[model samples]
Target: MHVVMTSAGIGRIEDGAVAVLDAPYPDPNTVIETTGSLDALGGAKVVRRIPLDGDELDLRAPLGRPRALWGVGLNYHSKAERTGRPAPDEPVLYLAGSSSVSAPGAAVRLPAEETVQMDYEAEIAVVIGRTLDRAAESEAWSAVAAITAANDMTARDVMKRTGTPALAKSFPGFTPLGASLLARDAIADPDAIGVRSWVGDERRQDSSSADMIFAIPELLARISRYAALRPGDVVLTGTPAGTGQDRDDFLRPGDTVRIEVDGVLPLTTHVRA
Candidate 1:
């Protein structure tokens, strides 16, 4: 089942329509709530059916108030090449706070100063279903509940000036999460999907997650060693090389950014001043 969090509340996509559940999940804040048993709402009937072409509901990230949002930097070979940095001995991790979360249709508010030089990084995000501590690499994928598309919008100038990406990365609405959360069973191979980003018609990133320097299992395993992985935690699997910074370009007000992974729904964000 594809789960979504909308202005109307938690919903399930069926028969090409979004059926609003009778009762929103008791904890409507995290994807973990849907893990293992989305059927918890089995007795609940659909209160309404919103057609896909109907006026779009205000969509929110499938997970509400995630306990932790972890971002991997330069995990993609292409990204490492573009940034002129060698691959790290270990994943370069950053904490993306819940405050940066935004729904698919939300506006990405740019700083008033045009010099912020915002850029977009399209990534495949994994949502954890169970708590994991020092999980074995072979067992990491088992802990994942779902996969979704995410756009890791960055403030390039701010990052360069501050010499820290996390500070610039945590701006409100910097993260535009997918509209649909596809359960793990739905994905044939989580590591082989295509991840791409576009600004209007300009394609900026086009690469597969298979090229990640550290695949999902290894990434999760390594991360688990550092901290406990709880349900509802999100792991952004890093972006490919085609960030705007690579082309000496950047996002501006009025631009629209679209990010997509092969198996999950796409996420679109409007850049606004």
Candidate 2:
């Protein structure tokens, strides 16, 4: 199922129509009402409907406000290599504030005098559907509800000054989320999802989850061992090699960054100062 947040409500892009869900947008009840089972959305009544391609709608972040956004660092071999560092022995994790979440078509306003070296990381984000505490690899997938694309935008200046991934990446509108979300079951191969990113007219990253050193199952299982993963929580599975930091390039006003994750929605963000 392809889920989207429309002005009317949470809706599904299926059955040749954009069927508005009876569940309200930003309400966790839709999933929570069913014990965090995203499959329960299949049973949600359609309050109303619109043409799938109609212009009478506006798209918002599919999840509205996720409970948390867990960012995984150096999870991709190519990404680590880009920094001339060896792949880490463990998942480098950071807890980004959910306040940074932005709608798919939103604009990213660069912080004034805080940082100008903005960068983008194209990543595939996993949306949790259940409460998982110390889950095993075999149990991780079952805890997942959907997959979405994320532009893990970073303010490199802040990171360099603070040396904290979470703080550096949690600026408002820093985490560009989605225009659509794909139900987990719709994906045949989670491990091989293709990920790509573009900075303005230039293509910056071109890699897939296949290049990730620690896959989703392992990442989720490992994280669950320490922190409880709950419904509406999202895990950003690091980006590919090519980034502005590696190329000595950074985002500037008027630049547009686009990220696409195969099997889910793609996102585009316009940069502003």
Global lDDT of each model?
0.82, 0.84
Clashing pairs in 2: none
Worst 10 residues of 1 by lDDT: 28-37
Counting only residues 3 or more apart in sequence or on different chains, how many pairs clash (N, Cα, C under 3 Å) in candidate 1?
Answer: 2
TM-score of each: 0.92, 0.93
Residues 64-84 of candidate 1: C-alpha lDDT, one tens digit per residue: 567789998889988888788
Off by over 4 Å in 2: 15-17, 24-34
Give me the candidate number with maximum lDDT. Answer: 2
Residue ranges of candidate 1 with Cα displaced over 4 Å = 24-44
- Number of the top candidate by TM-score? 2
The global Cα lDDT (0 to 1) of model 1 is: 0.82
Write model 2 residue lDDT over 23-98, tens digit each, in one string: 6435332554256655666888998888866788787777666777899888888878778898988899999989
Model 1 TM-score?
0.92
